[model samples]
Target: MSLPKSRLLVIGCVWPEPNSSAAGSRMLQLLQFFLAENYKITFVTTSARSEFAVDLEKMNITSEVIKMNHPSFDEMLKRISPDLVLFDRFMTEEQFGWRVDEICPEAVKILDTEDLHFLRKTRIEAFKKNIPAEEIYFDADITKREIASIYRCDLSLIISEVEMKLLQKEFNIPQNLLHYLPFLLEPISEEEKLSLPAFKNRKDFISIGNFLHEPNWNAVLYLKEKIWPLIRQELPDAKLNIYGSYPSQKIWNLHNEKEGFIVQGRAENAEIVMKNAKVCLAPIQFGAGLKGKLIQAMQCGTPSITTAIGAEGIAGALDWNGFITNQPKDFAQKAVQLYSEENLWENSAENGFRIINSRFNKEAFQHKLSERLLNLIQNIATYRQKNFIGKMLQHHQHRSTYFMAKFIEEKEKR
Candidate 1:
C-alpha cells in the first residue's frame, strides 16, 4: 500500500504572476518541485488576485484567499495540518509565522527569500545619495526584521550566492540555516542552439523586465538618460526596444522613433522578443538577486551587456555571456561590438549555454532541495535543538506578534 502524501502549505505575499515577474517564476518552480515530491500543496495569500496571476488549480494545486489579523486563519491551519509551511518572503513570515507556530507546532517552516530586501533597499538608497552601494549601512531596521525572520525559520532559501555569503560572513548567520538555490533551468542542447536564429537574422538591442520592479524602472531611466545616447552615436540606425510589464506613462513617454529608442510595454511573448534581438542591454545601477531578463536572453541565444551588480552570483567563475561594465560609454561600445561582430556574438552565446548548464542544472538543484527538506522533516526536533537562537526568537515573536494581531482583530470587529 502507498503511504499517505505529505501536506505542504505556502503563504504568499501575492499570487504568482509568472508572465510578469521573476519572483512569480521562482515560486512556481518551488511549487512544481513540491508537487513532484507528491506533496498535497495549498497556497494562500492575503493580497487581492491579479488577472496576470497563474492558475494554480490547473496545476493541481489548491489556492485560497486569506485575511490578516484574523483568527479564522488559525482554524484553517489546524484543519490543513501541514507537514511543511513555506513562506513566500520575510514579510509573509512576519505576518503569519506566529499563528502557524501556534496552530501547527510540528510543521517545518521555510522561507524562500526571493531576494534580500534589505540589501536591495540599502543599495538603492546609496545610489540616490551618489554614494557607493558598498558603503551603505547594513544594520537598518529592515535588515534587522528580515534577519530575525530568517533566524525564526528552520531554513531560508537564498536566491543568490553573493547574498548567502553576506548572510554568513557579514551578518554571521549560521550556514545550516541557509540554502543557495538560484533559477532552476533546463540544460540547452546542441539541437536547441542550432534552432535559434543566427546573428544575421536577429537585429536591434532589446531590454525587457517587469517595470513594477524599481530596478528595472531605474535601468530604463538610466538607458534613456545615459547609455542609449552613447549607443545612438555609434549606430544611429540600430534601435533599442524596451519591453516590460506595467509601464507607467513616464516610461511610455521615453519612446522616440526618431532616436531609435522604442518603449514597447508588456511583452506578450518574452521568449520570442528575446530570441529576435541581437543584443540585450541591462544597465542596472542597483538591485539584488538573479535577473530573469538576462537569463531569458541567454536561453534565447542572445548575448547581453550588464553591470557588475546585474551579473552578480549568476556567472560564478565562468566568463559572462557578453560584457560586464558600469560605465555608460563602455557599455554602449560593448553593445555595438556584440551586435555587429557575428563571431564574438556567437562565442558569447556559447558562454551563456555553458553558464546555464554548469551552474543552474534543474535536476541537480531539485535533488539537493529534496534531500535537504527530507532531512529537515526527519530531524526537525534535533535541528530546532541546535538552533537555540531560532527557538528564542520564536518564543518572543509569538508573544509580541500574537497580542498585536489580537488587538488589531478586536479593533476591526468593534
Candidate 2:
C-alpha cells in the first residue's frame, strides 16, 4: 500500500488574488508547487474573500476562513496535523506560529516573506525624508519584530538575493535559516518571442502595478508631477497609460486626455495590455523584492525605463530590457528613444527574454527547492539543532504571544 501523502498547511494573510497583485501571484505559484509535489494542501486565511480572489476549491485545494486569537484554530490544527506549515508572511506567522508550535511541535515551520516588510517600510521612510535608502534604520521597531519572526521560524524563504544578503550580512541571520527564492517562471521560447507583437505593432507608454502598493502610487504621482510632461513634450501625440488595481479617486483625477496621461484602472488581462505597449515606465523610487510588472513586461516583450530601485534583483549582470535612470530628463529621453527606434527596441526586448530564460527559469528553481525541502525534512532535527537562535526566539515568542493571544480571546468571550 502507498504511504499517506505529506500534509501542507498555508496560513495566508489574505486570500490569493493573482490578478490583483504580485503577492497574490507569488502565493498561487507556491501553492501550485506543493500541489505538483502531491502534497495535500489546505489554505487558511483570516481576510475577507474578495470577488477577485482565486477559487481554491476549483483547484481541489482545501481553503477555510480562519479566525484570529481563537481556540477553533487549535482544534483544527489537531485534526489536520499538517507535516508542514507555510506562513504566507511574517504577520501571519506572528499570529498563528505559537499555536502551531503548541499543537504540532514536530511540524516544519516555513515563513515565506513575500518581501522584507521592514526594508520596504524603511525605504519609504527614507524616500519621504529625502535620504538614501542605504541609510536604513536597522534599530527600527518593525525591524526588530520582522527579524524576530525570521528567527522564530525553522526556515524563511527570502524572495530577493539582495534581501537574503541583508539578513545575513546586516542581521547575522544564519545561512541555514534562510533560502533565496525568486519568481518562478517558464522560459520564453523563440516561437513565443516571434509571436509577440513586434516593436512596430505596439504603441504608447504603459505603467501598471497594484495601486494599493505605496511604491506604485508614488511612481504614478512621480510620473504625473515630474516625468510624463517631458516625454509628452518630445512626442506630443504619445500617451502614457496607467493601469493598476485599486486606483483611488486621486489616481483617476490624474487623467488628462489633452495631456495624454490616462489612468486605466485594473486591466482584465495584464499580459494583453503589456503586450500592446511600446515602452513601460516604472519610476519606482522605493520598493522591495522583484517588481512583477517589470517581469510581466519582459514576458510580454515590452522594453521598459525604470529607476535603479525598479530594476533591483530582477536583472542581474545582464543588459536591462530598456534603460535605467534616476533623472527625469534622461528617463523621458530614453523612453522616447526606445519608443521611436525599432532596432534598439528589438534588442532590448531580446535582452528581456534572455534575462527571463537565464535567471528565472521555473524548472531549475523548482528542482532546487524540491531537493532542499526534502533534505530539510529528512534532517529536521539536525536542521533545528543548527538553528539554536531560532529555538531561543521560538521559546520567548511562545511565552509572550501565547498569553497575549489568550487574553484577547478571553476578552472576546465577553
| Residue 24 displacement (Å), model 1 | 0.9
Worst 10 residues of 2 by lDDT: 1-10
Native-to-model Cα distance after best TM-score fit, residue 52 in candidate 1, in Å: 1.1
Predicted candidate 2 versus true structure: per-residue lDDT over 1-414, tens digit per residue: 111338999999999989889999999999988888988999999998889899999989998999999999999999999999999989999999999999999998999999999999999999899987667768678898899899888888999888999899988999988999999999999899989999878889999999889999999999999999998889999999999999999999999999999999999988899999999999999999999999999999999999999999998899999999999999989999999999999999999999999999988899888877887888889998887778898889889998999899999999
For every model shown, what is its TM-score relative to the native structure?
0.98, 0.98
Which segments of candidate 1 are over 4 A away from where they belong? Answer: 1-5
lDDT of candidate 1 over 324-408, digit per residue (tens): 9999999989988888899999999999999999999999998898888877877889999999988899899989998999999
C-alpha local distance difference test of each model: 0.92, 0.92
- Candidate 2 global TM-score: 0.98
Models, CA RMSD each: 1.6, 1.6
